[model samples]
Target: MKYEFIKSHEYLFPIEKMCKVLKVGCSSYFKWKSRPISKQLLLKEKIKQEIISIYFASKQRYGSPRITFELNVLGYKISRITVAKYMKEFGLRSKLSKKFKVTTNSKHSYLVVENVLDRNFEAKEPSKVWVSDITYIHTKEGFLYLTTIIDLYDRKIIGWSLNNGMSTKETSIAAWKMAVRNRKFDKGLIFHSDRGVQYANRKFAKMVESYGVIRSMSRKGNCWDNAVAESFFKSLKTELIYGNKLIKKEKMELVYVFKRKWTFS
Candidate 1:
């Protein structure tokens, strides 16, 4: 284990010095290197290479546990701890979003409705209750705002828009337009979102009211009221956005997953 760590950091530190600090003899280490490789050692090396391939293929989003699960599915009988140890030896770690950026700003004079959904995440039928939210994706150039409308019935993203601005027209209005166009506006369908100005502004309210649908807003400073949208945002950032490669804005274009219907600008 000590030798492996030393080998991993060899370029950063001196080998003889590392051997002395680790209480390992330089001659002994070289002897082990010159020894013939056994089948067991060969298998271990192959598995280690596979671990590296899986880690990078996931864009460094997967941790030791998830990688171990994948390896087991691929017929490798390895433990999670062993995988974790190998990853640590190679200084391999999952990428995580290190910074926090607030996207919800409820400091507007617009009216906000009551929490009609009321922590009820499930819906009985399609278009029963649709929740919308906004999240920021960090990129090399700047932050990108992603607005999504999800149907609680199937937990699918029915409509979405990605823009550089958080204006009502770019964020909420665009997503809502796509949603109403794709899904039928049913009676008693509750539209839920946070108390952001984009959702509560007069323009958005008028558009939603015209459809004869119910309006719902999460309570001020209470995220649990819109738990579904908040949780979805968290998962999306962690699994797809955060810790991934920094995307350049000019070259950015996302293909919508639903039937290749629309492209997100």
Candidate 2:
């Protein structure tokens, strides 16, 4: 190690002086520098390059384990620990997902329904239970609000809408309309959401009631009651919105593209 260190600094300092200062002999330093790179060292360099390539290809979202798996799939036999060591040597790290904030506006005169969903996130059939939530995305223009409706049976985002404002007509209602148009539901289908004003407002209530669907709301200040919707938002932020900047127009386009991808796949 001392000879290697002296060799690395030989260009900046006299080789003999560096070897003496580093407590390594000049002969040893020269010998080490003249020696051919070992096969293990060459392989380590190759693995480091592959790890960097895979890390950026995944948008820095893959840590050592996933990168190791991908490397193995690409015919490179490697271990997670070795990958982590190389990543540390190169100061490479996966981008961590940012925490998303809850956007429920429960302070309103609108009626708040009971917590009928009650943490029951499973549905036996399609459209039996639907969960919805609104979350805000930061854009250069301003904040864009996204409303999403998920079918609990398949955990698929059935409908979604993105707009500059969180108005009922533009946000929740638009998403609800899209979901209704896309899927046929039975009479006893449950629509669950946080007690946000948009969901609890009379207009939204009337809209759902007209379809003979039962309304279920989370208890006051309780986000876990609407865990499915919250989980969806967390995924959306982590996978799509985190560490990226988009204007309102671009954000809308992204939302449309994502919805299409989800719808088809």
Candidate 3:
């Protein structure tokens, strides 16, 4: 290991000095350097490059397990332990998830329905149950409010809208329209959200009622009723928006594109 270290840094420091500092003999270091690189060493180098590629491709959101799965999919025959070791050696780590602040304001006089879905996040078929929520992204100009409707069956973002304000029209209604356009609304389909004013407002409720959809609101002051939506926001903030300045719509658009690719790929 000392000789390998000396060889790796030889271009930056004198070999004799490194050998002296590491308490190794110059002759042994030279002899070790003259030997051909072993097959294991060559394989490790190749795996290192591949790990870096996969890490960046995931935007640094993939840890050892996912990276190991990707490597196996590519016929690399690598294990999670090896991937984790390499990641540790290279100081590569997945982005840590931060706690996201809830943006729901359930104090309105608007009517709210009981939790008919009742924390049953599972959906038997596509369009059977949908979850919606709003989150904000900070930019130089101001905050950009994002509203998303996800199909619970597949956990896909069926529709979304981005705006500078969190009004009912801009938030819930817009996202609902997009979701309606994208998927067939089954009769008695359940649309779930927190008792935020956007989702509780009579206008939005009537709009959803027009499509024969059942309205379900989270219990007052509780987020777990709509946990799926909150989890999606956490992933978005951790993987895309946290610790980054998104000043332009183009960047947000690019993020959306990457999100779709990551979700489907």
Candidate 4:
């Protein structure tokens, strides 16, 4: 039979109290507790810690399979199944993607500007042409609407905004402000976008006009006209937005993500 001892009993009758409570002698308990850890046990503990460190460093994207491969690359010889068992013990798993849809209001009476871009996304320099568009991302909360303006020359996203609702003010004005803050605009600099109400809105157009930038818009129902913006949205959605789970939609979300994405470039 197994027995447990209490500290209160230790002060009562010494060995007699311990033997009565524990049903084992204090000397035997001390000998067992004082035994040094085996070499094999120490090695196993070290390996377990190493595996845990690697698992967390991967940002939880890697399950045991990928972790096993990564460990091998790092000069660790371990079985794939063993890694899987470790990951399961640690509760590590990959994220799953959710479905998202586009929300561009093309059906409006707003005057569509000419397709000045003409599928020529390249620019000689920044501010010569800026392509803007809005894309949607799915998050656990709901749909996250993203608006971005990219420099045609460098394909760099100069400005962006993220919000829970698709409002005109939510898309263009915030991005325009960011762009103006980043770089000075010159006369004849073309600001191109699709015929969405956000771009065609009088307030947005006036803002662009104030900068002396030409307002260029895609033709009705034709996405190819604003191909630069379209392509940027496609790449962004494919590479980043689609894979990320939207926990909360905030203005600074895209800014933070883009900063990291650009760093990797």
Task: Score each candidate by Cα lDDT.
Answer: 0.84, 0.82, 0.84, 0.73
lDDT of 2 at 171: 87
Could you give candidate 2's per-residue lDDT for residues 1-265 as a string of tens digits?
7776775676799887876777777777777788999999898788889999988876776778778888999898888998999999888887765645556788889998888888999898998999999988876666778899999999988888888788899888999988988889889999999889999999999999999999999888788888888877665665566667553457657777667556611
CA lDDT of 130 in candidate 2? 94
Model 1 accuracy (lDDT, Cα) = 0.84
Candidate 1 collision pairs: none
Query: Clashes in each model (backbone N, CA, C under 3 Å)?
Result: 0, 0, 0, 0
- Please write out the lDDT profile of model 4 over residues 134-251, one tens digit for every residue: 9887666667787888887788878877777777788899888888887777799988888888988788888789878988887778888877777666655645654455445554
State the TM-score for model 1: 0.66
* Overall local distance difference test of candidate 4: 0.73
Query: Which TM-score value belongs to model 2?
Result: 0.67
Candidate 3 lDDT over 1-265, as tens digits, reads 8887887797899988988898999999888888999999898899899999999887888779878988889888888999999999999998864534456888889898989999999988899999999988766555678889999999998888888778999999998888888888768999999889999988999989998999898898788989999888767765666556544645467456545654520
TM-scores, all models, native as reference: 0.66, 0.67, 0.68, 0.59
Cα lDDT over the full model 3: 0.84
Candidate 3 Cα outliers beyond 4 Å, as residue runs: 1-50, 63-89, 96-102, 220-224, 243-246, 249-265
Arrange candidates by TM-score, highest first: which order?
A: 3, 2, 1, 4
